[model samples]
Target chain A: MNIIESITKSDKNISDYKSNLQKISLDKLRVNPIPSSKNEIWRQTNKSKFYRFLDFKFNNDFYYPQIPGNTKNHNICRIIIGENKKIKFKEKKWEIKELEEKEIYNFLEQKIIQSDTTQNWSNLLNHFLTDRKNIIGLNISGKEIPSLEIICNSMTNFLNSKTLLVNIEEETSVSISQINIGDKNSALSISTYFNIGKESVVNHGIISFGNNKSHIINTLNVRQHKNSEYILGSLQYEYDFARLEININQVEGNAKTNIKGIQITKNNEQISTYANISFNGPNGFLDQLNKSLANDKSHSVFEGLIIVPQIAQKTDASQLSRNLLLSNYAKIDTKPQLEIVADDVKCMHGATISQLNEDEVFYMRSRGLTLEEASKLQLRSYYQEIISFLPISKERWDLLALLLKDK
Target chain B: MERKKEIKQPLLEIRDLFASTENLTILKGVNIKINPGEIHAIMGRNGCGKSTLSKIIAGHPSYEITSGQIELCGKDIEPLEPEERAQSGIFLGFQYPIEIPGVSNLEFLRVATNARRKFQKKEELDTFEFEELVKEKLDIVKMDSAFLSRSINQGFSGGEKKRNEILQMALLEPKIAILDETDSGLDIDALRIVASGIKKIANKNSGIILITHYQRLLDEIKPDFVHVMADGKIIKTGDSNLALELEKNGYDWTDEFINKK
Candidate 1:
């Protein structure tokens, strides 16, 4: 399939992008063979379970799932399912557009397509499978914009991918949330790239829920400029198999990055999370916290790495991974890696794996709480640290509460 | 020379209690009776099993009562669970309160209060009414309203944690309150406030059993009887003057007296 010809035939607004995408579509066709368990990065996640679904063709005749009513908040809500996309605004103050123009094409081509998108198989597949009209662009400046929400659903047997490019202009702040809910027997992937301008702030949240027999993958790449701040809070709760990879690069001095994530898996499910943060300038800062809970023979993996180069002096970075194994048969793999080439950087990492505390349970029980009530309280508090970082709307909270369901 | 006369219908009674943990005996044939409107301070040295007695009474799962009977209001509560014992008007103010990272103090108190109320077949308070009730009890410990919003004792100092214990005691209003070493980590000012808080909650229908290592707390809150426990058994029982005598003479006198016997 020629990607450029496919995109050009779908929409006229992106006719100019067809030629540019033509230059990269040939490179996207060179698929990296599916990684095997022998590979170090693929050791924790068994890739054999996903190989049979790799060559699936797009299912265009399936029903486009409707966006549920609970997701319609006071903010700007956009629903994207297959080729049908709709955007509604309650109070419009920000810019929302499609990335079919010249400037966005240049940025996406240079910074994303020609870069390490070649190395990631999911990125390569996304580049080949996704239409250019499926890309959404958001820009916020000089205003307090409400949270922009995107609800994505995949009813196809093959990959249903969407890309979001968000830019926060100098000294502005904005929040974005992307939710993926897919049907069983479908495979989906979503990628988001953030361009944080100087002294601006951006808060991004991604939540993915999949039914049994579903496979999903999500990727986030961020570039932060001088004095900018970026926070990524995510909850990946349900799936038969899922993986989330986040890469953050500090482009200049004094940029900050905060990442918080929670992953819950049960019933033979498997979930993996990878977070890599690099400091390229001096006085950069990063704080990353990730937690996972696995039960009933399930498996959960968390890998966090922070890199500080010599030019990035006085970088402050800390990463901690806390995991809980509910059943004796459950498995959790956590490793926090810190590679520091700078002489003056302050970086530390720690990982802890523990069960529900006996003393804490007894304490609650001594206070008249039954065993079930006590355990429920402890479990709720376990995720409160990350849940509190989510957006404050009732709808968002309800979505966050899904993390604790059936625990 | 004589112990105070026992009131009718004792609140808590332990008859010939013998308990141990993991085959190591801690309490050897301990016996005591506490009645309403009275404060009994059990004074002992380290390893004399004062805390073991408190834990056994509270039904801590770690300890096994080899042979004993623990009765509340003349009914055997030996087979009840810890929460069951608690809902039956027995409160154990922990010597070291555990810090729960995410459970708010307010929510814990509300759950505990409702659990007891439900056990007693009473109506549970709604959120607004429960908040009002908790606010009134907050004054008993002189605590700031901000502490209620925080995780239970997550970052509390030693004194603040002790005050929180007292605040919970005030909220539950248990018929029998057993405070184990509530005076250990307190300064004099905190000691005064905590002692007064205990006093404020103590009433004619409720009894208090205070376990302490010092007579200084006895100076603030006088106990009706001071029992000297050595090697897990009460060797001497006397009036309040026995606490002063023990503070002046120390446990050496008890060892000498036991050696002579």
Candidate 2:
């Protein structure tokens, strides 16, 4: 099936509710099932939002974004591309290509690999499983570069592809940051995949900005080997309905994973993120910190769970979700869960949701600071907590700080 | 805006000022006034409106002014926000100062001083100049210069924090200074240092309104006038000798003396 025919079929055959033993791809639609009135997740969350997103359509065309310019002098490479699908990254090569026919069919055939929750498995596959045909493999073997920068161009037209692969060399290391930028007001859909090698380290950062009235759904699938380290960082701004789906598979023991995410939304925007980390190997460690800021009637939802299998012992993992509600109407749904089958495992989870500090506000204002000045100062201080964790040079840090000034 | 038209009225005027927090009316139609070139001592009982009055004049949102007016230099300042009133030259030396973590004292002082300077459209001190200015002010407060490197009021002792609060007031140079129980948590030595610092920094251009529950501070920092506050109102005003009389006789001293006068 082609892209248009496939999308048309997906738009047609999607049922309100699935009855019997649902197909793996169809399980993605398990988001809002019937007796939905009794859904616990929807008790505090507005259930109508799922239906509102059903009417969103994708825009067709590819607009590769240019790197944000730095007014200050810096030594970083500039990866600039035009308003076309063609992208040229001079830093390093980690490009996505069309997947083989067999590879595409195999992934689509087994779209649903069941374990614990089938909440998003069926629907995601039923709609997205078939059309995936893109493949990006990581080749960090022979030649080494300073850094591996993957500049992904935006989609003017919606296309569903599958099986993007990344293979890192054994004992080799590289850092990749995909800067996603598009028009200020548009809808977008994208998928990404990663495959790690043994004894290698991977540093990946996904930064995206979607305009108002826009929607983004990104999926990341990773497979880690023994002694490999993976750090996944994501930052999103704007985007009315922004969603990120992260699936981490620890295929080997002694591997480590760290996932850090930060999102800032305004203007009645809604963002829901679902991330899952599974352990297939023992002695694995996972650390994650997710923070969201909601202002101007915006809403943010962070639903994440860490699953440790019975055999996956000696695993040390933690997840934290923090949110700041900037306005009275702004809302946050932050829940972090730890599901461990092993009794001896070391795992913990916690979350915090709050507004700006009143005493701090008063302290700042008492010093002749205005409300806006005080709030900005507090915001800068708040972001500093995470910015301190970023592994960028002072120059890059300053540049990012200036970009987030108005933010 | 600061540095605007000359304001030559009494530095502060609290006229029939009735204030409350929650349902408790702390200031029941109290009135007091102070002009430049003079220090006024307001000695009151523990539950009197001394601190509440200080917070009200500072425009603390928690305190409500039911039916009264407070004017600064003849202009009604009751309508302004706390920060606006602060920028308009009103300072409150809190007895129980707050410790705000993460904000360095230097950064806080610079931001505060620059805010006032911004309001006044006066030349602001650059980094180098600000360091010198802060150093001088720290000495004026008799505080160690290392305090500037610490967070605002964080981990500071009672005396150090109070001295820092006074340091901020001196740096801001508000027209009216209300020291609310400032000497409550200080030792004899700390009190002497703090009282002398206040006396040294406050010029005749600024009116010092000192509120204390004890007459000890009044003795150390001699005032031109002493007012005895009772039931949220000042019922007696006399020369500095009134503080000595009240010190020797307690509340009944002012009560009997006022009843006779």
RMSD of each: 4.5, 6.5
lDDT per model, in order?
Answer: 0.79, 0.69
* lDDT per residue as tens, model 1, B1-261: 123445679999888889999999988888898887889999989899999998888888999999989899998988999888889889998899899998999999999988888887888888778899899988988889898999999999998999999998987878899999999999999999999899899887788999998998999888998999988788889989999998888898778766776
Tell me the tens digit of each residue's lDDT in model 1 across A76-171. 545453444544343454554443467567766675466543336555555545566666665556457767666666664665666667666788
Give me the TM-scores for chain A across all models, comma-separated. Answer: 0.87, 0.76
Model number with the top lDDT: 1
Q: After superposition on all CA atoms, how large is the RMSD of candidate 1?
A: 4.5
Model 2 gets an lDDT of: 0.69
Model 1 clash count equals 0
